[model samples]
Target chain A: TYTASALAFALRNLPVPVILVGSQRSSDRPSSDSVLNMKTSLAIFKEAPFGEVVVCMHGTISDDYVLAHRGVKVRKMHSSRRDAFQSINDAPLARVDFPGMRFKMLNPRFIARGRREDFQVVSKFSDRVVLLKFYPGMECGIIDFLVDRGYRAIVFEGTGLGHIRNACVDSVARATEEGVLTIVTTQTIFGRVNMNVYSTGRRLLKAGAIPGHDILSEVAYVKLSWMLGSYPGLDRKDYVELFHRNIAYEYNPIHKDSLFPVWSHEY
Target chain B: TYTASALAFALRNLPVPVILVGSQRSSDRPSSDSVLNMKTSLAIFKEAPFGEVVVCMHGTISDDYVLAHRGVKVRKMHSSRRDAFQSINDAPLARVDFPGMRFKMLNPRFIARGRREDFQVVSKFSDRVVLLKFYPGMECGIIDFLVDRGYRAIVFEGTGLGHIRNACVDSVARATEEGVLTIVTTQTIFGRVNMNVYSTGRRLLKAGAIPGHDILSEVAYVKLSWMLGSYPGLDRKDYVELFHRNIAYEYNPIHKDSLFPVWSHEY
Candidate 1:
């Protein structure tokens, strides 16, 4: 979803639309929601307002509607629920009513369709990228392993506000010295990755890790791969610029309302 | 919060109640909630119905009540908010009303206070335990690093449904062979850790990683440290038995209503 959205955003000037869809339950299961979800997604694909990349999934457990989530903002929250996919930190682009075939716009800024001649495809992807989730006791040697394997980019799924164990800092610095592009995203899925809040995060910045502002780790991985693959000859500076830029809506500004959900006093 | 809860739970048969409290915002700020939160926690400590380890924090941002959450089932969800601490998969043990100092029971299974002879301290903690969070493209050398460090146990904060990258399985098996106790918890935070649902999880089981069964990764780390410290002579089998046994309310059965919050459709 992240990569597809980045690609769509990078080529937003084009006339073509990109729709990413998936099933929560298998088609064979009696309780499977796969068929309805697929049909609803197809319906949205044929007539969505924008040419951007979007994810269409069951908005609720019932088959009444499908949500068109901006690909960059969507996430799979549950392991096996039919309504697992949710738009994080932002509302879905629109909701597509099932049987009625009606569209309700949620976010007002969606782009409109344009001429077909502007469409172009950029399919390059570098396989030499890695995503590493940091924990309390991870060893520094793991970073060395990536550098040894000729990995060009590493996206860290770091702890609170984008931090790694202090012991791992030297290795990250070594990786930077060796010219590996490093990025940090928070493991807390809902929040932004801010490397300026703590000394550890500051040290990481000194070690040359770019803070992935509010981008999901998965999206960062996809974006890094897409960037490296699409522009094979770019230098480290160029790569960093592309990594931080909001090619798609991947870097949404944090909203106060989105920080925490409102709770009813009755609970 | 996790360590405090584990310690309190380990000594739960005590005659006195154990209360764990933290302020989301520091005391100096003008909008600081520290004073009210502290007063509410004190009210709970003096009159809570049980002798268990319970977390006392703001039940709501309004300062209307303080929730006494079972230590084992509690987690810090937000980085910087007055209502950051929450009870996962279960309702809080009790809610204490402000001003009036009223205690309303939520969960009916709380244990009552007992004799002083039941109180015993288990202060020994093995410093050799480790916690590792797994992510894509992580190298196996991390496992070897722990084994080489003479670590007795590892708690893994794995991906969805308790999974790690397939390439790291052999390292886990090697650690198991070397007598390191391995446990798996999900990074998702809200759900249970079930290694039976996916091939990667099953493989982790085969590699001797015990499913932590909804125990938060932080709590698991604290529990393992406490267990190893309390019973230094126990072998791998004893460790496994102690790992699964709910000494506290840490492994409560999931409540259906707790799966997701009720969202108002007006958004």
Candidate 2:
């Protein structure tokens, strides 16, 4: 769900020098990303050391441009186009020209993971949950469908700290009656959901929706499904226990810098 | 956006107790939250002498219940009901209930903070963005439509580690051409997106789409919107810069927490 910060975030422990490549213009627009991406990719492959986190894209305002960037240091500035990529929090690793996609090193890099790890499917999805992404001026009773469908779980991405309009109280009630699991997540990108912070948020909490803490709706969905699968026979108390345990790396025991995967103590 | 956690997270700085209140059932249901929430809210409010971060929710299977939970140690188990709340890594501040509630607490809770200076809004969004939740067999070219509609940024909630079908390459190219900032976030809920870890992901990256580390798309959207709004004249480069800066506590900057917000972070 990281719209603009994905590249840098993903580059942390990459096996090789990761280069995020993008275009500010379209290939259909006669001045697209093909050349720039090609050039940047070549630049990183040629200029930067064999391994490190980097971003590769158009380096200059002209078409004959391309650049390689550090993955942790890159971001998207233009919403669309070949040259939209840039270095964030730092400068690029190298530059290149599409004319043979020549490389020019701007910085050096090193890889901690010598080779890429086999990306095993580590998702522990909680099954049978549906999400209701509540929006402004949204209609009420949309959640009723989940209960009708006999879903085991429902995650709501509410505005702010999981606050939904007061119009859907009945829908939530019905879902609870049907024994459907309901969780609340914030629509805002950052920040945790503390039910006691605001009256509106408190109301939603009072309505039976559990705070997803800082969990995103998408993550909640998978976790809910996983929980349902893991301990279907457990009573409410045991179920709660299973839900809270960090069987996977879903919730960090503490908000610390080491929470990242590469530097984490375990695989 | 973190209503309870923020207050609770900040309550670490306050000298008074912070309690998150909720109901196990909605008031609309025959089994509703009114009794539990009322009892719990009152209990925590009256017990404010011992400053702490407490989550107030239905304390028992009975409607007459409430528990003052410590935020750093609480967990929400059920998806939709009030009784699903519990203390995972820490003890609850205090348990309060009507005479008829099903259970009683056996321990006293610890206080975290009392002053209010620890909490504030720190979000920086990229306003020019939107999120496109993807499903298997989804329609192609929807990305192009958004670009045509002038959306500068988009997040694609891909199936696993940021993957999309090759059927929409043209739309992706078009999106890039329009200066549309694009990135891929996984739909698997937890875990980071490793593009080089997969051919499909690598293709998307080559097409100019960035991989969102472990951020959920919903969070990315709000952050992007906020960042975009904050910098009126920011071009793509400025957009990138602002996007990379950690604000609103949305991104797991150094390394993704391998999992997501679902797995409880034991305090």
lDDT for each candidate structure = 0.75, 0.54
Interface RMSD of each: 3.9, 15.7
Q: Taking the tens digit of each residue's C-alpha lDDT, what string does model 1 give over A142-245?
A: 68978888998988888767899788889889999998999998766655777887899999999999998778787888788889888888888999998888
lDDT of 2 at A253: 27
Deviation from native of the Cα of residue B107 in model 1, angstroms: 2.6
Candidate 2 wrong stretches, greater than 4 Å: A1-267, B1-21, B27-79, B83-128, B252-267
Count the clashes in each prediction. Answer: 0, 95
Q: Considering every candidate listed, which one attains the maximal DockQ? A: 1
Tell me the native contact fraction for each prediction.
0.05, 0.00
Q: Identify the leading candidate in terms of lDDT.
A: 1
lDDT of 1 at A245: 84
For candidate 1, write residues B1-267 as lDDT tens digits.
545656664684767668777776667787777777778777777777688888788877777888888887776654455676777666788887887788787887676877888778777777787776665555677678779879989888887678888998998999999999999987666567778877888898999999988787878888888899888888888889998887876786654644444432224
Classified by CAPRI criteria, candidate 1 counts as: acceptable
What lDDT score goes with residue B98 in model 1? 83
Q: Which candidate leads the pack in TM-score?
A: 1
